[model samples]
Target: NTTAAAVAMLRDIPVHMSYSIAVIDRQGNYATVYVNPDRPAEVVERRVSTNHQHGVEWAWHAETTKSVEREAAVEKLLLASASIKDVLSGFQRPPAYQIQYGHDCGTLYTAVYRPLDASVELVWPGSLWRQSCADFQDEVRTIRFNDGGSGGLAPTFKEGAVSS
Candidate 1:
């Protein structure tokens, strides 16, 4: 049910280029929703019924070696979201942030959102779809980073920031 909402959000977003899109639930589980057939097939989704090895992994961690101008663009874009504002309000108190990477012409912002807990949550959303999501799973994998106190999505937090 939640996966369907994520997919709907992807389709509603307008993009200039073809790109694939995927979304991870609060539990770090991912499901591919958009796949650009124009691009080469990368992440192929499998009908796994209690099977753990059917889906392709996502590039949960990444960096553009060529310094794409998209990084700055993403930061600026995310600043517009309510989530960023909430984090910036108390970034130094606890839950230190380590920016990973982002994409788009100032459209996508990807990074970790940590609260009182040491664990972190990967939050990214862009204005453009880079390509169909056909190869996304193969190209990206859910990244697990050890930081903060416990891991969780902070903006939509609970129990005064986090819980074990």
Candidate 2:
């Protein structure tokens, strides 16, 4: 019911471009809705989008290699009970994970949400943080980024002790 309500809410919003939204209820039931100006909203169990429309069949709409590879990786990740760490660790290379350069798109952060526990986990360069709706903690920390192409972990922060 919640997923249906969420989908209905998206239908009322004005869309300027193609995008997908995944909603999961507390019961672990989820719905992924794809919306585009070219066609009606569609529901899929899993989908990936990147500046390309999936609603309409356009000869010009090409799926980037990045998107294709990611889609396949995501499919494998989704098949198992993957944790936030599992998902984050899965994207270990270019396209899915990029370091910001002169003017290229770089992955800033990855977030995982748990509807049942009302919790969210986030991963940055070399840092991992998680918080629950019931026990939110705010702290100041620094993360360093390795702009150089060294095969070492960069943008790392000291693991601070977390209290519940």
Candidate 3:
């Protein structure tokens, strides 16, 4: 997966490029990449997220007010963040900043990846867990609802950790 590859690359080399990469492992381990072409070897080492947003190779999706609001919220957090944890906090639920796809889709989990520690914290709609990079596997974790309320698309998982 691209996200896994990105995290692995970050661990092994200086990833400086023009694009964004988001990776999450089975244990909710994740890494988001923000690259700048001008500085092709420097990693910002921060947290970032994306949802249905367009990129260089993709066309912009139909933007709704909600999507714009979510993007704005993320950007605001990123700009005001003083630490990586602060940025990760933006993905937390309650106010429902995390996106849900509706009855057929729901917010399954939110993840935070710390490259410095090579650790990932996962937030399920009803639970939470953490995993280390060394223990991570390229497998998807599935959560089954007891109420037969099946909803949520599992995010992809990637392997490897960032080594400073």
In TM-score terms, which candidate is top? 2
> Model 1: residues >4 Å from true position, as ranges?
27-29, 35-164
User: Which run of 10 residues does model 3 get worst, by summed lDDT?
Assistant: 145-154
Clashing pairs in 3: none
Q: Weakest 10 consecutive residues, lDDT, candidate 1?
A: 46-55
Model 1 score (lDDT): 0.35
Candidate with top lDDT is 2
Residues 66-156 of candidate 2 have per-residue lDDT tens digits of: 4454555666665663585676676544545555432343455677778888998777755668888898887554544445454533333
Q: Write the per-residue lDDT of candidate 1 for residues 1-164, one digit (tens) a residue.
A: 35557666665666554445545555544665444434332343521111012232333322321122223333444466467556443332112223222332121123442222323433432111122223322233333232233332222112122222
What are the Cα lDDT values of the candidates?
0.35, 0.61, 0.51
Candidate 2 local lDDT, residue 159 = 54
Ranking according to TM-score, highest score first: 2, 3, 1
Cα TM-score of candidate 2: 0.68
Q: Rank the candidates by lDDT, best first.
A: 2, 3, 1
Of models 2 and 3, which has the larger TM-score?
A: 2
